[model samples]
Target chain A: MKSAKAKAHTNIALIKYWGKKDPKLFLPMNSSLSLTLDAFYTETEVILDGNLEMDQFILNDEIQGEAETTKISNFLNLFRQETGILTPAKVTSQNFVPTAAGLASSASAFAALGAAMNEVSGMKADPTTLSTFVRRGSGSATRSVFGGFVEWQMGTCNEDSHAIQIDDASWDIAMVTVAVNTGKKTISSRQGMQLTVDTSPFYASWVETAATDLVDIKQAIRNQDFQQLGEITESNGMKMHGTMLGARPPFTYMEPTTIDVLAAVRQLRQQGFEAYYTMDAGPNVKVLCHLSDSEKIQMKLKEAFPNNPVIISKVGGGIELLS
Target chain B: MKSAKAKAHTNIALIKYWGKKDPKLFLPMNSSLSLTLDAFYTETEVILDGNLEMDQFILNDEIQGEAETTKISNFLNLFRQETGILTPAKVTSQNFVPTAAGLASSASAFAALGAAMNEVSGMKADPTTLSTFVRRGSGSATRSVFGGFVEWQMGTCNEDSHAIQIDDASWDIAMVTVAVNTGKKTISSRQGMQLTVDTSPFYASWVETAATDLVDIKQAIRNQDFQQLGEITESNGMKMHGTMLGARPPFTYMEPTTIDVLAAVRQLRQQGFEAYYTMDAGPNVKVLCHLSDSEKIQMKLKEAFPNNPVIISKVGGGIELLS
Candidate 1:
């Protein structure tokens, strides 16, 4: 048995990926840019065993049900198809992230799984091949395979719709994650995005504006224009949620506390700090701000929400083979 | 002094008019539909006194400031332009609505003023003509000139963009006004609409979809389809706020309590009552439910926020001369 262990940090999108262009292949409707965070991540180990009748999937030290295990097995089958390696594999995964509340956990889960499977298969594939392969598991996992600022390009087909590292993000940027609610999400991002794509009247505009935002934010990052970068990020995220509100049976990820945190972040700017807020498809809010002000922002958020966790995170590294 | 006293009820838009295609002329970018509520209204007395030096504008009992007086004066000037009345009228207006929140006070205010001026000037203007006249003062006021479900047609020219009564609304539909925040609105609906038009990436789609929803809701009203009517109204209101969220330096009228009320409304539906919530440019929420269930929904909302005012209202009449 050849076993390999790998880990990948989670990434929070600045310009979000909300809908799928091709859900079957996990192709995004638009290009998305993200900042990989140091605090939250996932690690997975793959064991290639020829004796096993089927691939066994264990998450958090417990063997998963058939439905859950089959997802991993299907992903492993894709790996075998790509690498010409046909061996049953046992996969064990653990998340350092919080309770699922739509935190892009599948991103790091699939990225780590794909990396470990690649290692065990002895197919020393390049990072691009690895990212594209894992994208079939989850669209956002494409960006998690790379560190710092990453962009998942909305390619025309399966081959080019992969993520690339844009910047090292080793500068003055940081994020404060206000985990307002960590309950299992009522509407998964996959379901929400499909709903938005199928029914939201504003979705076509979202697809168009998100593409333009990606270009502008890339320029902002190149110039290190923090203000431009933050503004584009915040507005792009709002537009993503905006599309969901126009769906047939409209929905919102913004809970009351999510709005409270957003107001506090705006107040930080009023008090002369550079803090901007963005929300994915959940009640939680993530603030992108200066690394120097993270402690102050965290303290202010703590004052507002004494019970909830307010975490400060800096730029993180990409996926790696664990020692 | 020939004084005419007129009273008009404020209307809550179901298909909201959020932007201006011709802002200067107060031509809305999209047509809107609204339900005229009987509870909150305004009364205005316009005296065509040519002996007065200038138009004296008094709201409630207090004389208004120069800016406020100028706005009333300007609206009156347009009234004079249309009717050949050059009188510098003494205008006294009183609102029965709550504190100066964005509760569409201007709708009733302008409609009452227009009706009073029309009476004093002896223009003998029909309802359509009167609605067109008041639209210059406030766009939504065009709808306030009628009772029940009124549709403010988004005409290309000033002569045609007036409201027409679509449904008498004497049926099963009713509304519960949940006053989340009656304090003065930070961003006036006028300014917010312009901001959305100028910067919100979602505004264009809003324009297109709003037009579609207006048509669909009108049909729903004609058929007395409560479910379809409620769905369109809720989705339309959400789409309106969704545009504001995508605006540059985004803003929202939903406070924490506003969301609380909204959650309660949705919960009522889960408990098998036909209820739906809608919001405008302020933190207040208004729920449209079955007239039979208004009391139950209002009671639940009142329990959730005992300090807040929850008023139940039914279909109201158009502008009328008060004895």
Candidate 2:
């Protein structure tokens, strides 16, 4: 068996995916849009050989436990089954981004893994096909397989529910990520999504509105309307968090730093800077702005949160086979 | 001219009123439910005299500014119109609760003023009519006119939209108010409500779900189901905040200490204390639990927030006039 290595960058959702229509199949309830970023990425190497007795997984040079390895093994099994390769695989992965901190590290992780596994197994699947395969491991990873602007369509079936590139995102759009909390969250996105879906009274409305937002955002992207895009992105992200707030025994992911960053972003906008912010299921906030103003926005955010890591990223490319 | 004094206690909404269908009339877009608390209240004295040049308003032993005086003057004018009394009035009010910061001080303030105005004008309006009059000043004040559990019905017109007692709340229900922030909020309730109504995409859904929550909670109150009531109360409060989150240039009222109090409440529930928390438009959180557990919850909250004020209150009575 041949070994393959690949790298893929993380993507931040402009329109979030909050709930699963079919948890077992990993089908989302609403379509989502995202902007793939260059600042954070994951690289993975995979080797399939008959000599391997069991699958092995290593993350960031540390050996993973059975639970973590088992997840990776199951994901590889999808590619193995497709290519009729019964040999166990050894996978090594490294992340440049903060893992499990609402930064969409999984988007890069699974996207790279899928690309590497596909190459090792000689599947030679196209990007769209690879996205469908990677989505089984992480839903947002489907968008990471494409470059720049991507949209994941929440189709009725597994075969149809795949992501596609919407734009090259070669325009002036960029993001300033404020890493407020790099620590792992108490609740995972998977667990949080399930809780919101099962208990939130606003879940149905979230699904409906997210679809509308998806449509509006796509139009804004097509027109290169930065203001409209930023507005919808901010609104969509809040709607996703809103659903979580309405969940039973309601919880919020926002910390004081999250609010502070948001206030700073608002202040920046008031100062004539065209900046808007969006957050995932953690304390970190990502400020969307024009590429030309990214440095100034970063400076303002750094002044407000002097201790936190503030990084600026432009649009990134899709998964690539390194060697 | 004869002067009359009346007192009314503050009431915190379990199902919140987020927006108004008619801003001019102070009519809410959704029905809301609240619990009248014994710990916080306001007293006001009103006197209508033909010799008075204009309305004079004093609050907490200090002369109020023109804005506050004008608000009180306009509220008294409602009674003037009803009773055909052209004379201006002198209104003096004092609060037992923290004045803003989500303590629902406006509930008690306007309820007391309405009761006093009703008596001085010789309108002799019933509690329901007085509630409607008070609602024009503050929406939550409509519920404050009644003792125990009250529901403000979101009627189509001003004549029909009023508060009525849902339960006398003679049961063991009580609240431990954690005054996390007593200072005035940067965003007032009136301004926040307008922003949410005009900007939030989820505002309509908030109205719809709040109506349903009101129904479910009223039934829970009737059955005296503590767990159900607490669950609905917590969910409703979160839903209200959720709408605020989705507002354009989104904002949240939750502070770091507010989240700390919420976590403590959840911890108490996890430890089988049957405690649940609800917040208004500020950082303070009110833990709803059995009257038997109020002291214990208070102790735990005090331990968690050593510096903040923690007060326990049971079911309070309706507005009453003094001779």
Candidate 3:
């Protein structure tokens, strides 16, 4: 079978996706908006080979163990069922972003894998169909199928639930990522989300508030109101983390450095710069700002966190076939 | 001019009071529940001395500066207005707890001062009247007016809002205070609460959810259900902090060590102990547990943070005249 390689960039949720309504189908409890970024991405090559006894998976040139390989194999089974390809696949993937550190690595990873599979299987599916295929691998992956600002609609079922692009983000907006800890988090996002859903008393409220935030943010983007967009993004993220704290055996992904970065962002805004911050289920903080203020924000974050890594990323495109 | 001394113990809120509806009256946006602890207490003496030129204030044997002296003097003015005593008083106070480190030192401080003023001025106010009096000095102090478990109702006006005893806490409940940082927090609780109220988009939801948590926790206390009480207490504290995180230019009182202590508390609960943690606007954590499990939880926390001070405290009494 012909081999195909594809690339997909990571996306940071402005309106966060924290809980699941249907875990088996990977359906979110509320719609989420995200910005696909250019700085970090993943590339995966897939080829179906009848000679292979079983599926082989390599990540960043390193062979994955049973657990990682099994996850990929099961994910690929979805594609196999659709295209009627029974041959075991050899998959080699490389991630430029940090994994399991709230950087949305799985988003790019699965989106690329899905795109590569679509090509190798000769499916020629549209972006919407590709989003559904990618989402089965990771919920956030559905948004990575489109460029700029995308929203993943939390439809009642699998078929109706998919991502739609809100804006191309060709405006003056950009993001600066402060990597407090690029290493893997002790608790995975999946585990943390599940814990919050099962134990947090405020879980239902979080879903309701997130839905409201999604609507507000979409309107803000349509109106090109940066302030409203930033405000909703910051509030939505806090609500998500709040649910985690209220969860049974409460947990927090924020470290002291994370707070420091956020404080710096606030200070910048106080100093007449329009900047706001949002954090996911890890220690890193991502600041949403105008493209003009990106360098200034990056410098300020670097000065505050001299030891940590700080990177600036522009809005990125959707999944692409890399021949 | 009869001088009187009174003692009141510190109370840590399980359901937090973060915002103010009437800032001048010190009325909270939501009712809060707290447990008065035996470990930390404040002693204050008040005398309506006609010989004094102005109100004098001393804390822990140290003559307080203008700001602190003024605060005590202003609080004393309320007492003077009620009892028709225009004489400038001499106020001396001592705190056995760590001040401003999220140990609820102000709770005990104002409660003791209220009791002393009541005695010296001869107001003959009961506990409910005394609660309203203490609330003017500090909101949490309203709860400190009573021993055992107390709830500060978020009344519509100054007269109606006051704390009442929820339960005697005569059961197996106890608390272990982990002094993660004994130093004063840079952001005072008053300042922090105002910032959150003004800036956080989640502030309204926090108030609503806290009201629900208050009802649930009070019911749990009535049923003498340690598990339910502990669960609601932990969730309530997290929700309060989550609001702060959503604040514009978001702020968090949680340090790295604070998260460490919380993780330890969760581990303890997982190991069959019913330990739960609650925090205010400071980095320190107070763990609520059964009297039987208190020692074990303290030992475990001590093992985790060898440098920090861990003190166990049981149910304490209401304000009492010491002289």
Candidate 4:
């Protein structure tokens, strides 16, 4: 048996990746940018053995259900097709995230899996090849291939729709993750994105504006304009979620406590703390602000939500293959 | 003094009236449909006196400030120019709706004002004429001039962009309004609408889809297809609010309690109830259902929100000029 292990950080989109132009190939309708966070990540190990009858998935030291195993096998098939490896593999994952908080755990999970698979296969693929490969597992996983600030250009084809690092994010930037009380999310990101694309009236507009937002947010990063970056990030995320509200069955990820968290972030801004909020396809709200203010903001959020956990995170590194 | 009093029921747009093509003339970008409710209304008396120094504005039996007076005077000026009446009228209003709840008291207020002014000036105007006249004061008021299910056409110019009754809504339709707890809205509807029109990436799509929704809902009304009507009404209203979430400075009217009410409504749906909810530019949620089920739904909502108020309303009549 030949095995390899890798770890990848979770990335949160500043310019969100929403609908896909091609779902099978994972080609996005618009480009997106994301920031890899230090707080949460996933470690994945892939073992290749001729003795294995079928692919096995182990998650959090426990055997996963058939659904989870099947998804992993399908994702592994993408690598199998590319690397010409026919032997099934045992895949193990340790996800260090608030399990059902709507955080993008799939991002790190797939990124780590892709990296470990590449290592196990003795494949020295470049960033673009790795990004496109992992994207098949999850669209947002495209950005988790790189560290700091990364932008995934929505290329017209599968090969070109790859993520590239934009900035090292050495600035004093931070995010306070408010893991608000959330029930199991009914609408998965894949289902929500497809629904928005197929039925939302605002989908076309979302695609168009997201492209512009990618450019604007990049410039904000270049200028080290915290306020501009924060505003664009918040606005872009809101617009992404906004399209979901216009879907055929019209759904929103916001729960009651989510609104309360947002109001608290706005209150922080009013009190001279430059905190801005961004939400993904779940009820949890993340506040982006200066690293110096993160502890204070976390304290404030704690007061507002005594029972919830507020974690502050800084910039994280790119995927790493363990020796 | 020549005076006429009129009473108008507040109409809540199903295919919501959002944004404007011509703000000055109050020409909506997309046609909308609404259901007038009997529970809330406004009474206005327009007193035309040739000897009065200037227009005197009174609201809810109290004298209004200069800002309110100026707005009323401007609305009156349109009538003055068209009817050749130079008299400065005393406009007194009795508001029977929740103030600042975003229940669209302006719809009834403007409709009644338009009717009273027409009667006082001896103008035997048709519904189209009255709709166009009232629309200058408020856009949704165009539908308030008619009763039951009304459609306001988004005509190319001022004259054509008027409302007409599509159905008497005598098919046992009813609504249960949930007045969720809310703070004073940070952004007014007029300001929010303009922001959405000017900045929301989804604005154009909203206008286009809203037109389609209007057409489909009107046909549903004609066919008495309760399911189709309810779905379209709920989707359209959600789309309208969705645009605001994509605005430059994104905003949401959803409060914490508002989401709870929506959840409660969804729970009712899960329990095999044919109840759907819609919201305006306020934190309140109104559930639409059959008249036979309204009381039951209201009871359920009351149980969910024991401290809040839930009121049931039926189809309302058109604007009436009280002799």
Model 1 spans with C-alpha error above 4 angstroms: none
**Candidate 2 lDDT over residue span A1-323, tens digit each:** 77999999999999998888888778999999999999899999998877989999999999999999999988988987898987888899999989989998999999999999988889989998888899999999999999999999888888889999999999998999999899989999999999999987778878887888899999999999999999999888887888888787677888877877887888899999999899998889999999999999888888888999999999999999999
As a whole number from 0 to 100, the lDDT of residue B226 in candidate 1 is 90
Better of 1 and 4 by TM-score: 1
Q: Could you tell me the lDDT of residue A309 within candidate 3?
A: 88
Ranking by TM-score: 1, 4, 2, 3
RMSD of 4: 1.8
Put down candidate 1 lDDT per residue, A96-214, tens digits, no spaces. 88756757888899999999998999886899878899999988899999999999988999889989999989889999999989999888888999999999878888888888899
Arrange candidates, best DockQ first: 4, 1, 2, 3
Across B1-323, the per-residue lDDT of candidate 1 in tens digits comes to 78899999999999998999898789999999999999999999998886999989899899998999999988888877877778788999999988557678999999999999988988869999889989999999999999999999989998999999988899988899989889898888889999999998888889998988988998898888898998999999998988887888778888988878888889889999889889988999989988888888888888888999999999899999984
Model 4 per-residue lDDT tens digits across residues B234-259: 89989988998899889999998988
Give all candidates' CA lDDT scores: 0.90, 0.89, 0.88, 0.89
Per-residue C-alpha lDDT of model 2 across residues B143-195, encoded as one tens digit per residue: 99999999899888888899999999999989899998899899998899999
**Residue B313 of candidate 4: its Cα lDDT?**
97
Clashing pairs in 1: none
Q: Whole-model lDDT, candidate 3? A: 0.88
Better of 3 and 4 by TM-score: 4
| Tens digit per residue, CA lDDT, model 4, A202-250 | 8888888888888899999999999999999889989988898899889
